[model samples]
Target: MVDEFLKWYFSQRPVLASQLGADGHDHTLGDFSAAGLTAREREEECWLDRLSRTETPTLDDAIDRDLVLSHLRGSIAMQSWPEWRRDPSAYLGPVFASMFNPFQQRLKPEPELVAAAISRLAEVPAVLAACRANLDPDLAAPLLVQRGLGQARTGRNFLTRTVPSMVEDPDLRARLAAAAEPAAAAFDDLVTFLEGFTCGGTWRMGEKLYSTLLRERELLGYGAAELHEKGRAAWAELDARMREVALRVNGTQDWRAAMETLMDDHPPTLEDMRAEYEAETLRARDFVRERELVTFPEGEECQVLPSAEYARPILAVAHYLAPPPLSSSRTGVFFVPYTPDGFTPEQVRQRLRTNCRAQMPSIAVHEAYPGHHWHLSYLAAGSRTARKVFRTPYFTEGWALYVEKMLHEQGYFDTPATELAHLDCRIFRAARIVVDTALHCEDMSIEQAEEFMATRASLSPGTAQGEVNRYCAWPTQAPSYLTGAIEIERIKESFTGTPREFHDRIAGSGGLPLGLAEQAALA
Candidate 1:
């Protein structure tokens, strides 16, 4: 039954199949190329109804049953929302991701790969047209539409400028260039259409729908109000700790000023950013190994790279891309965006402050060792196919955030300054919880969200705006970092074991929700 379901699921998401390094679906772009939105929703509903009525297989293991139930509920919950049909920005993810996937994992030969790219590029118009047809003009949010326009422009630039340079074959380059024109035109059409619409739609998910989403998608037993309260408590605790550290470092009560002091000690050049991150990643990995914090997979490697041009608009300063779970390779890519030459000296300095020397170690811990790269490597090695395919964002993101604090508690940072960096990240995530909930479940305006984040999270106005824009486009995802980490710490308190044992158990559980992880741990 599981096998049948997996096969059916992959068929519906061919782009996912490509990303997972699966074969037999390489030639086609799948549903993502031209997602039949209405039909897809109806199909999801039917599948959920069928799965709910079916008996659980007696032979299924405990983890399998947990995965199956979670997967079904999450899928149903996602389909229950009409975000994809309403928001044009939502469509941009799959469109760009499909184009980018072929370059990430090369399961095919050069000729076949180039051919695949060409084929996918040729289909871009049809995909955008379908997206246009699916999006409801009445339900479009202004902020989201504006963001979508920016993303569309980025995509167009990538197709024309970046992609052609990536291909060596002259014929393939010409074909790609030709295909880009129509795709770029389609994007222009989308922009013009969106510009004509008045901006009045709400991005708010509301309290009822938001709470239900948490229950179903995250498997959280708590309601929205409870989570918000927990987030507030976490924020207070972290804030107090940060102030204490700041007082020790600067001999003053001004924690934010101390943080600003650390930000000034950043890399001198944009080129140094990658080098700093790479060194810190190695240091973090070494610390984890010496402490025997968790088991490391053999031959697992991670590369630090500059963020692609198309991705810089939406990505944070640093982000990690794990190898596909089913891929033959276990190498992960950590991308950090370099400050462009077009920026003024002040702009460059401000941009580099995000990766200051004191903060690099904590960022390294969160993105690489004992964090996303390490966590994902374990899942790739030990997770079942079904478990790998279905993930809970709360668990995946939560585990990463939890490890940042875990490593600090183990005396990894060793200095008040470094510790402050870790605390700052915690506070930032906590702020995410408050702001994300407020933005989506309340009547908080975009400008208000930007200001709130800038003041509370110590983010610059530009950074806060970018963060708020992301929250607006992607409802509920921003808060998962804090919410997930809180759940993880709660689960950790219940287990009686060595730190290594606890860490291993959590990593070995794949990417199950905290509730499901607790159930599995106790079982």
Candidate 2:
């Protein structure tokens, strides 16, 4: 039954299937038309009903059934807040990924990859047409529309320039260009369509839906009210720590001033910044190995690269992309954003400061090394398809955040400066919980959220804006960093084992919800 459901599931989301290394769907895009969405929702309901009726005879079978049910429920719930009918930016993911995934993977032959890209590229117009037909400008969020414009523009640039430049074969290049021309035109049409919306609806998820998602979808065991309070408390604790470290770093209790002093000590160029990240990643991996902190999966490699043009708008500073679990390649890419074109000198400096030397170690450890790359490698190496496909932010993001603290405790910081940077990051995570909750459930205005982040989280105005926009788009995810880590820490209190043993047990639990992860880890 699970296998049957997965086959049908992957068929509906070809881009996701491709990303997971599932074959036969690389040349298609997801259906977002109203009828298509209706069909999808109906199919999901069918699966939910069927899965709920099945009897589990073993513990593993029961767990697998629960995972499938959880995924179905989440998918069904998301349809209620339909991005296809609202956010014009929603369609850009599969549209861009359709071409990007095929081109980036090293496993496929060049000819096969180019053929897939061309097939997907030819469908781009149809996908964008779906976006046009499905989207109601009256329901569109103005902020999301604005973001869509930037993304579409960048995506158009990619289709015309970056993608064409990536091709090498003369015949394939000509075919790619032939397909790309229409795809680029589709993007231009998308941009024009998006520009017509001068008014928009609310982006808020509201209290009831937000709370339901926390309890049901995420299985996080807490609602927005309680999570908001937890965030406040976490922020307060981290604030106090930051002040103490600030006094040590620069003889002052004002951490913001101390941060300024440290920001000045950074790499000079983007090349230098990328190099610094590469070096820190290697150093962190060496430290983890020397300490035997956790089990390392053999043959996994992490590479540092610049963020793609279209992706930089959302990625902000950096992000980690895990390799496809079903693929033969064991390579993950850590993308660091280059300074965007047309930025003022001050904006460019702010970008550099965010990726500054003092902050790079924590960022490196969080995005690579024993954080995402290391933790995901274990899950990828596992034999279960359900485990490889069903990931929750609570486990994935939480484990990454937890390891930052773990490494700090294991004497990985090496200097007071790095410690201060780590604490500042902790403050930001705490602040995320607060801001994310407020924006979604507490009726906080986007402007207010941006200000709160800029002042409380000590983020630059530009960075704060981007962060708040993300929070508005992705409800209930920002808090996972801290809240999930707290759950892991709670699980740790009763376990008496080596740090490596405990880490290995939980980190390999298939990205389950915190509650289920505890049960699986302790079992």
Candidate 3:
């Protein structure tokens, strides 16, 4: 039953299959680009109804049952939102991903890869046409539409400026260039159309749907109000800890000032920044292995690379791309955004401040060793197809944040400055919960969200704006990190075993929601 369901799911989302490291589907883009709004909703409803009618297999274990149920519920919850029809950025993601997925992996020869990319590129016109038809002008959120325009511009630049260099064959390059022209024009048309319109749609999911989303997608028992309260408490606790550390470091009670001093300790240039990150990643891996914090998978490695041009606009200072579970490759890519040459000296300083020496280790740990790359490597190696295919931000992001705390407790942050940075990271995540809930569930405006993040989380004005822009474009996702981590910590407190044993149990449970993970862990 699971196998049949997976096969159908993959068929409906061929681009997803390519992203997951599946082969043979390389030549085709998915139905996502072509499906109209009504058709897409209908398909989702049909799947939900069908899954509801299907009986759970009697032989299924706790983890298997949890995985299956979570996937079904999460899919239904996602489909309940009209984000695909309302948010242009929603469509832009899959379009950009379809182009990037094929090139990211080395599953095929260069010629075959170029051919697949060309094939996908040729469908770009039809995809954008479908996108234009599917989006309802009445339901378009102005903020999201503007953001989508930015993304489309990035995608256009990628097609025109970056992609040709990636193709070697003269014939393939020519074909790509020809296909890209129409696609780029379509993107221009989209931007023009979006700019002419005024936004009337609300970005808010509202309290009721927001509650349902938490229950279904994250499997969290808490409501939005409760989660917000928890987030506040966590923020207070971390802030207090940072205050203590601040006193120890600088003989002042002002943690924020201490944080600023630490931020001033960044590497001098972007090249040095990359080199520092690489070194920190290695150091983290060594610490994890030497102390036997968690079992490391053999042959699992991560490479630090500069973020792709199209992705840098929305990406933070650093992010990770885990290897596809079904793919033969075990290597992950940790992408760090480099300083663009166009940036002025002040802008460069601001960027560097975000990647200070005190903060780099925490970011490295969260993105590379004993964090996303490490946790995902285990899932890719040990999990079934269904488990690998279905994931939650809570489990993925939560585990990474949880490990950050775990490492701190294990003395990973040896210096007062690093410890302050670690606490600051947690505080930032906690703030995300407050800001995300307020922005979506309350009547918080984008400007208000930016102010809150800047004042409370101590983010620079530019960084705060970027973060708010992300929250506006993607609702509820930003808060999952802290929420998931809190749940994991609660589950850990209930365990009677050692820390390693607790971690092993969670790791072995695939990417189940915290509620489901707890149930499986206890079972």
Runs in model 3 deviating more than 4 A are 32-37, 57-62, 168-175, 339-343
The runs of at least 3 residues in candidate 2 whose Cα sits more than 4 Å from the true structure, single-residue gaps closed, are none
lDDT score, candidate 2, position 507? 85
Q: Model 2, 17-55: lDDT tens per residue?
A: 989999888877777778987898899999999999999
Candidate number of the best lDDT: 2
Which candidate comes out best when scored by TM-score? 2
Model 1, range 410-444, lDDT digits (tens) per residue?
99989989988889988999988888888777857
Stretches of candidate 1 exceeding 4 Å from the true structure: 32-35, 56-62, 168-175, 339-345
TM-score of model 1 (CA atoms): 0.94
Model 3 is weakest, by summed lDDT over 10 consecutive residues, at: 57-66
Candidate 3, RMSD to the unseen true structure: 2.1
TM-score of each: 0.94, 0.97, 0.94
Q: lDDT per model, in order?
A: 0.77, 0.84, 0.78
Q: List the residue pairs that clash in candidate 2.
A: none
Query: What value of lDDT does candidate 3 attain over all alpha carbons?
Result: 0.78
Compose the digit string of candidate 3's lDDT tens values, residues 1-523: 5677677677777778888877667766666543444565566566666655666644334455557666666666766567767887666777677776566655677678777877887777766776677677777777777777767767677886578667777787777777777778888887777677676876777777777778876778877888778878888888888889999778997988888888888999877888899999999999998888888777898998777777766765688888888977778888886654455788777778888999998999999888899988877887567778888888889989999998998899999989989989999999999888888787577889899888777577778888888887777788899888878988888898877777877876677787778876776
lDDT of 3 at 261: 80
Clashing pairs in 1: none
